[model samples]
Target: MNLDSIKQSLSLWPTELWLLFITLLGLVLASFINVVIYRLPLILRREWGETNLPEISLSWPSSHCPKCKTPLSWRHNLPLVSWLIQQGCCVKCKQKISLQYPLVELAGGSLALLIAWRFGANLSSLVYLGFALSLLALAVIDAQTQLLPDKITLPLVWAGLTWHWVFSSSQMFDQAFLGALLGYLSLWSLFWVFKLLTGREGMGYGDFKLLAAIGAWLGAPALVPVVMLASISGLLVALVLKLNAKWQGQALPFGPHLVIGCLVLLIGGQELAGWLGLGAWLEITSWAF
Candidate 1:
């Protein structure tokens, strides 16, 4: 068959098949992300003198049980299925594994499916899928450890700017640059003001960087709604934790809420703006850019 005919034939495959493939790919990525979420912090801690350990890179040490350090075979490393098969325990050590493994896999699969459903087979879809996955990893890491490494956040900022410059006609590079600057400054200014008045840090510098990365992707027009949605969600979560006595007077990390907001804007920013009676504002801002 001619190349065009082959392309047409491939396109004719069922959407279900494509979605299933995306979901499986997402699960695999999630497995890797689990390793990242678990290891990146330790690696950083070691660098910062918080821990004494041999140099460990993400790729050097194969997947293994933390308690027993037994290298996992392929059967034990099959993402969610393996976890289920083992009943969330190590096959050799019988030690209970954290539910985070399966949970991250499930989230990754769900996000991938959603991206596929929304954008179909397109470059934009793949780009957004990657962004969503990064956010997922950052959210989980920050929630567990209250830290967002510059390694991920800095690369994400550059990636966003590069993506728009190369692929997007609607969003210009300057807009992304301004969005990043403003996004970082907004939170950073708030943090200092709050600290100056109350003598307590309101949020970490990592939160600022995360928002800046989001702005770089979505542009300045998106910053307000993202922050608004994030603040509301964060407040609700904090209140819930406080009521449940789970807060323990510790400040909750804001990165997850920011990730949620960024995802919301990514998936349906125009609709959200319309719902909030800010459709005109977004339109005006788009025109200005």
Candidate 2:
């Protein structure tokens, strides 16, 4: 067969190699998100002087059953497969698994595949794949722990800036730079204003950084719409929780809201922006008007 035919044949194979790669990649990321979800808060706390970094390295301790303290085996650690096989129980101690493990793996893999399909083979796609995974981990970690780790959020910001400079030196760079600045400043200002009025801390600084990361990937113009979308989603979530009586005094992390907003922007920001006529509307509605 000719080279084009050979390429087409591989592309048409029953199991695309890229899909398989993403599936395997998802499991690996899920395993690590488990670690990040658990440890990121601790790391953040240490950095903020709220707590001392434990003298014991978090990693020296192997992955162990929280219930039984029995070390998990490689067989048990096989991501989604192991969870299915073991019926969501510890193989060694038979302790019931949280089901979070498989769920996170599945989410990560599915999202990765989605991104791959959307962007295809390119530098933006790769960075975005990582971005989606990081956001997923942050969203889950914040939901469970009410904390967003600087370790992850900061690196993401840097990655966004660096990725923009490396791959897209023109408009992409401008978008990323403006996005990062606007994303951070807008939230940071809102936080202070809210605190001044309400006499309560409204959100964490890490939330700003997460938005900044979004700006880095998408651009500054995305900030307004993203925040608006997030606000609407958050209100709905809060209302649901309140009605359900699941809303204790516990503060909801804003990270997930921002993640959802960013995802929306990533997929359809331009269309949404055009439909809303956001720029012109803002100009007309400004106090100067």
Candidate 3:
């Protein structure tokens, strides 16, 4: 077809087709997310002044069964399909796989669809899709191990600042910068205050940076609601754990709650804020840049 005809043909494509494409891309990336979640921690453990840890990396190890150490064939690594077909067992050793694999893929796929629907077919959609995936990885990592890798959260801070500078208004960029600064400072201050009073560190530096990265995206005005949501969710869960005899005294990580708070605020900002009685605060602060 000629150039004009080709352009016209592409434009004639249906919305469902675009959705399918985005969903497939998300699923493919989810496989990689699994790799990052598993290996990134090991890599970090190795790097933190440990001389004997075996070398590992996101790209070098290649996909394999963690138990068997056998490399997976292409068919064996097909996102959610492989897990289902194999009954969540390693093909070589018949080792039962963690349910995390398929769940992450599903979450990634759903996130892709949400981004496509919310932001539509545009650069913001792509940017936010990747952002969402990073948050997903962070949430899972923190929930499982209570560790948030600086490798991910640190770059997230810079990425948010860069994204705004390139694609957002100057005012928005300013908000992002302010958000990062205020985000880190606010949490850092709280952490030290708690430590001083109780002779215990209430949270980690990773949480400070995670909030800072969030601020970089949603701006300083958004910080109050984000923190409030995170605190409330975290408190509720803490209460439940404290009440349970078996789970009492378990330390809860705040990073995953922060991620959940950020996503909920991002996707349902106006409505959610109103429900939480923060709508007036959001408006007074001009929550958007």
Candidate 4:
């Protein structure tokens, strides 16, 4: 069959099968994201000052049980499937694996399914899928390690700019570039001001970059709305954590809240606003691609 014929044949597949395919794709990607979430922080810490730590990169030190260091074979390495098969315990040491692995995979798959449903099976689906996953990974990593490596955030910022410059029909590069600048400066300014007032840093530099990436992808008009959404959601969560006995003293990470704001704007921007009676406010901000 010609390429066009193949495309037509593929497009005619039942919606269920397409959903399954998208979910599997997302699971595979999320599996790798789990690796990054676990290992990236170690790699960064080693780079910073942990000279005594063993040399390791994403490609190096192959996957293994962190507790007992047993190598995992392909059979036990499948994403959600393997987790279910193994019942969340290591084959050799019987060490319990964190529930996070399968949870992240599930989140990734569901998010992918939602994106495919929203954007359709097109190149935009692929792009936004990757973007959303990247944000998810960063959120989890930040929640755990409280560090947002420039490695991820910088690339994301640049990727957003490049996407607009190359493919975006309505979003212009100038808006993206300025969005990034304003996003970074907005948090950075707050950081310094809070520090000046209390003699302590209130947030990390990673937050500034993460917001910049969001702004870059969503545009300058999105800055205020995104921050508002992030702050509200983040503060609510923080309050909950404070009320909990165990989490009262722990520092809360803001990156995840910022990620939530970005996703909300990216996925449900106009419709969600309208539903919540923020249509006029959202329109006044003109938050759109």
TM-score leader: 3
Candidate 2's TM-score reads 0.83
Question: Candidate 2, overall lDDT?
Answer: 0.75
Cα-based lDDT at residue 111, candidate 1:
89
Q: Tell me the TM-score of each prediction against the true structure.
A: 0.91, 0.83, 0.92, 0.91
lDDT of 1 at 277: 76
Q: What overall lDDT goes with each candidate model?
A: 0.86, 0.75, 0.88, 0.85
Look at candidate 1 and give me any clashing residue pairs: none
Task: Encode model 1's per-residue lDDT on 1-42: one tens digit a residue.
Answer: 875675566566578987888788888998999999999988
Candidate 3 per-residue lDDT, tens place, 1-289, comes to 6756654654565778867888898999988999999988888888887768769888987788889899988999999999999999999999899999999999999988877776665566667889889999999999988998899999999999999998788888999999999999999999999999999998989999999999998888889888888988999999888888898586789999999899878776677788989888878877664
Poorly placed runs, candidate 2 (over 4 Å): 1-15, 43-59, 268-289
Question: How does residue 156 of candidate 3 score in lDDT?
Answer: 96
Clashes of 1: 0
Per-residue lDDT for 1-289 in model 2, tens only?
A: 7746655654554436665666577668768777667666766677668664653234756777868979877887887888898888887788798877778888878777766566554444456878888998889988888777777888888988887787665766887888889889989999999999999999998898898888877777677778888998999988888887655856888899999888766755455655756767434433110
- TM-score for predicted model 1 compared with the true structure: 0.91
lDDT of 2 at 57: 39
Candidate 1 regions exceeding 4 Å error are 1-14, 287-289
Judging by lDDT, tell me the better candidate of 1 and 4: 1
Better TM-score candidate (2, 4): 4
lDDT of 2 at 110: 79
